[model samples]
Target: MSKKFVLIYGDAFVDYIAEDQSNSRFTKFLGGATVNVAAGVARLGAASSFITVTGENETSEFVRNELAEEGVDLSFSQIVPEKEVSGVYVHLLENNERHFERYVDVTPDIQVDFSAIKNEIIHETSVFHFCSGTLFHPIALGTTRKIVENMKKSNVLISFDANIRPLRWSSEESCRETISSFFNMVDILKLTEEELFFLTETTSIEDGIKSMQQYNIEALLITIGAEGTYAVLHGEVVHVPVEKVIPVDTTGAGDAFVAGILSKIYLEGHPSTKEDWIRYIAFSNRLGGICATKPGALSAMPRLKDLQ
Candidate 1:
């Protein structure tokens, strides 16, 4: 049977992207890390399913239409009451990186229950992608934890991304504690160098690797912006350099990278050796590099043909 890629994004935010922080004009995109991953996977000709909750508002309609057009399965998505609205995030692009300010006060109303879809969808899932953004919302955290625990019992490979947005959490200490607990369930872990420090409380990559051994993780990917990425598998780490691109907007680049790696591994099965991981990382780097050359997250995500 072909592996099905399932992405859970409880916190689906409408992104208002701006080139200059002071600009009054903003370009909107269906944002959220997991959403980008789902779209990118579909673009790569993979069966990608997205799980999210939104209302009947304009933001929700836009997101729904966009995902449908991308060929992403939204069978697990929920449409809440009209008064409830999706979260909104405003991003400012500078120095090939992104700065975010979010309006998620209304997200509590956009509730989700993973148990509702457990038997119908998640049971048949192969790769379950989980990002830490959902943890920021108390209403979503309970269901998120339940899904992770269930995924563990079902023997599904859990792919995790620490797309940490500290400002959204109650406190940095709380964020660290909660995110650390999640590491125990992760099989394939991906995070930026800074996020690695936050979760592991270590100053260097070597120390971070040592701390990660306590978890169920089989492989770890540490992305160092601009410098490249470090892929660790079976106790060995290999550095993969990124291809250069004149970035127009770096939004969704990391999410695109995750999708690229997932597409390769899902199609061929998980990497067995360091060389295999290196090759996957190189391919992912190219996808991310290409994403940087465009604008918006999903809009920037490259198709398989684009990479070829």
Candidate 2:
């Protein structure tokens, strides 16, 4: 049997991507990286599942329906009618990293009964994917920690995206401190080269990989944008080059990579060993490269057939 790939996302939304033009068109897709990963996995015809909490409003309902459409297992997601959905403000630039501002007014505390999360998500999860953006919020921070502690017993392969943001954290030092601490707990750490630099204040990719290896992490995926990707596993480094495509918008490229990597691992790696993980990183990088060539993150996500 293949190990299940379970992902957790902070459910919120926005027409985040605006631009510096009068005739700018804003395309609204699922905003959160975790949520985008879920959709990306589903697009590849894999069993991608997500756990999240949303407010009891139209926004929450829309997100639920989107998850359903993607066929992601939503057994762990919550709809707290007391809160409002999270949101983002994206400033789009033609070929630059999209700028962002987030909103979480009425953000409420969330608690998921471990019994329920395990029964529904853990027993079946081969790998657990986590995000850093959601941790910036105090309301959901402790809840995140509890989920991590509760889920450890299952021996699921842990993957954390140190998706760091200076604007969101209390201070640069504080964010880096928390991120470094958390990455130690997870098995595989995925993030862009920029994130690694920000979190560790290190400039070299080799040094960054070495830094993460201290955590006893099995693998590290460093997304290098249009230049492609690099990975280090069990002290051996491998590189996957990207295929250049005229990019419309690189918004979901990284999320697509996460999906592709997890899907390949879940499908090809029944045993889910350290060895299998090394191979998964290579294939995952290819998936990300494929995403960069296309437009929207969800739409840009490649099918399994594309890999062949």
Candidate 3:
């Protein structure tokens, strides 16, 4: 049987989240968009495999341990003694919204090499998921492209999330251009309202979809927070709503959402019809909604037991 795991690639981050606007008191947690998704999928009772590089220091050890405890497979991950994991300081607003204050990285050049991944892993991967977090680094970018091309040849489903971090890119144009270049290659693309506007330079969702129609992407999902998701699947547009929830912290909600969708795809096969797509989107929205009701990113991700 195929491994049926969601293969994820990206950087691992140590998130220092502030308790309040003061930004004085902070708590550390295992983070990064891909980390959250990998853990979240595993929590939902699906197989998840992570591809990342970490250092030999205490912080890196903590990240590795946390991911292993979360049931994520790290057999393919690498350890670089000189690589210091990146850190992001997130500040909480009065409304409990999270804001990325700053980022710290000592060795951004260290990244996973495409040659390190075994052929068997690629053959077994049911879906390959990635984001834009590490694309700014040339080495990482090249590796990502190589891996994506290989996965495509193996007929694996490719999922791309435009998890845009403005601070990581040199400029808005560079970010937009770099991310847009991968549109035609992805099987599924997820973006936020702000990200859609930024990439397409359009004010409305309709126009944004119109602008992206040229890519002929299989599926495009626009997350609209509580309002739910706006999806464009095979030239068809649909609105999927979600249950309302008072958010305590919106951190990791998008990751949870993507996890839900990926886990569902891994457990059940990919959606083949409009109704099928809607069901998957609705399930994902519920996960996102539930995640927003709690604190922290990876900590807030819903588990299969939580749903039961």
User: Which pairs of residues collide in model 2?
Assistant: 16-90, 18-90, 18-92
Report how far off residue 55 is in candidate 2 (Å).
Answer: 2.6
What lDDT tens digits, residue by residue, belong to model 1 across residues 217-263? Answer: 77788988677898777667778999777888788999999998888
Best by lDDT: 3
The top-ranked prediction according to TM-score is: 3
Give the least accurate 10-residue stretch of model 1, judged by summed lDDT.
81-90
* Per-residue C-alpha lDDT of model 2 across residues 186-297, encoded as one tens digit per residue: 7777879899777766899888776666767667778898777777766677776766666666767788878877777666663256557556655666777777666555
Q: 1 or 3: which has the higher TM-score?
A: 3
lDDT tens string, model 3, 97-138? 788889999998889978887888888898999999999889
TM-score of each: 0.93, 0.87, 0.98
Better of 1 and 2 by TM-score: 1
List clashing residue pairs in candidate 1. Answer: none
Alpha-carbon lDDT, every model: 0.79, 0.69, 0.93
Candidate 3's error at 243, in angstroms? 0.7
After aligning candidate 3 to the native by TM-score, how far in Å is the CA of 36 from where it should be? 0.1
